[model samples]
Target: MSDASFSLNGTHPTVNWLGQVRAPGTPGSLPLIRQTVVEAAETCGFCDEDVAKIEMAVGEACTNIIEHSYSTQPLNLDIEVKVGRYDNRLEVTILDYSSINFAVDQMAAVPLDDYIATGRRRGLGLFIIQSFVDKVEHRFVCGQGNELKLTKFFA
Candidate 1:
């Protein structure tokens, strides 16, 4: 929990629990990231099922950052994770620093049925993430970095 601030619309504070993790952008660092997110979600009163979903969604985001964005290089970049509990919802953001040019916001998850038909062993990370979370938002700042925002509402 550094001196970083969490604001929803860039005006007011939105996060109740704020945390940041600096890990080598590699697959070996994913478990640490997932553990942190699960703990945060649990503290926010998320049920077992919802907690598992959050873990998987955040893991998917981290996997992408490791495998694609950072190219499995040194984990020198700052990978930030923020967990915020709203009145009726919980929001989580995963930020990473990378130079890879990607349009995650404009990409659509391949349909599950189609994915299954193709018999591809991998490539459903984003789809699984989108299916579990209520909302997913992606943003890439020109000089800042990439942000993958995940939101889940309590029922």
Candidate 2:
């Protein structure tokens, strides 16, 4: 199926922040995403530290989405962040037509001890992301793009 265009949804109570971009996926999107998501979360009452973490983690997740999810005229991705009172969490979901193939668990259990032992300075994005988020989930279509869900809860 063709990717859908990005649109504003004004009816979702929980959708405090959302944005979609079709530009060429690049490293530069990282900073832009971090700033936008964090600013929006702060507006919704997320703590400063929590906001910073969420921004960083979400930026990493989005980078993964862009790099791994779509190919050949990439599809539009939907990002939705809901800031709640009890949880004060940021929920991010990516939409596309590609099947889900990324694994957060595999990424989370990074064998940090080995890395530390070797003093390796790589493969830190996933590790950093797991440290920030309380939960990460995956919803995949049979032959469609995967929805990568990332959440960061503020304490």
Candidate 3:
């Protein structure tokens, strides 16, 4: 586990700039990442159910990075996570320093009925993430790394 850095930035006095966390690209760091996101959501006045959804979504994303993005390389790299609170939504940005270019467009939607009927236990990370979050955006740069931004609007 690593120390998380928090800051407060806003044009007005009521808003806050949640925090940022950097954890090793491994399954062991998921709990911390999830906890940080949960806290940010709660602080931003998200309900319990929504907070749970956000936690699960963020966890799945980090898991995908660890298992797929960094699979070929060593586990020494770090996954940077930033949580922010806006007027009507909460945003979470996950950055991975893997050199592998993940083909986000190539991910096809999973048929839930058949998937469940077959008792499949894998390959649903992106589905869960899309279902849970209000918006999902990802981009990969040649040398910058991969960035996944998830946003959940307040209801």
Which has the greatest lDDT?
A: 3
Model 2 global lDDT (CA atoms, 0 to 1): 0.60
| Full ranking by lDDT | 3, 1, 2
TM-score versus the correct structure, for each prediction: 0.84, 0.66, 0.86
Model 3 lDDT per residue over 40-78, tens place: 999888899999999999999899889988888864889
Evaluate all candidate structures by whole-model CA lDDT and list the values in order: 0.79, 0.60, 0.84
lDDT of 2 by residue, 11-61 (tens): 443343344333334565566656656665676577778777777777777
Q: Which stretches of candidate 2 lie over 4 Å from their true place?
A: 1-23, 66-88, 96-100, 105-108
> Which scores higher on lDDT, 1 or 3?
3
**Candidate 1 local lDDT, residue 18:** 46
Per-residue lDDT of 1-155 in model 1, one digit per residue for the tens?
74344676777645566455667666778888888888778877889999999999888878878778877545467677777776677888888887665555567999999999999999998897888899988888876778888999888
| Stretches of candidate 1 exceeding 4 Å from the true structure | 2-14, 72-76
RMSD (CA, Å), candidate 2 to true, equals: 6.5
Worst 10 residues of 3 by lDDT: 1-10
The Cα RMSD in angstroms, rounded to one decimal, for candidate 3 relative to the true structure is 4.1
Lowest lDDT 10-residue stretch of candidate 1: 12-21
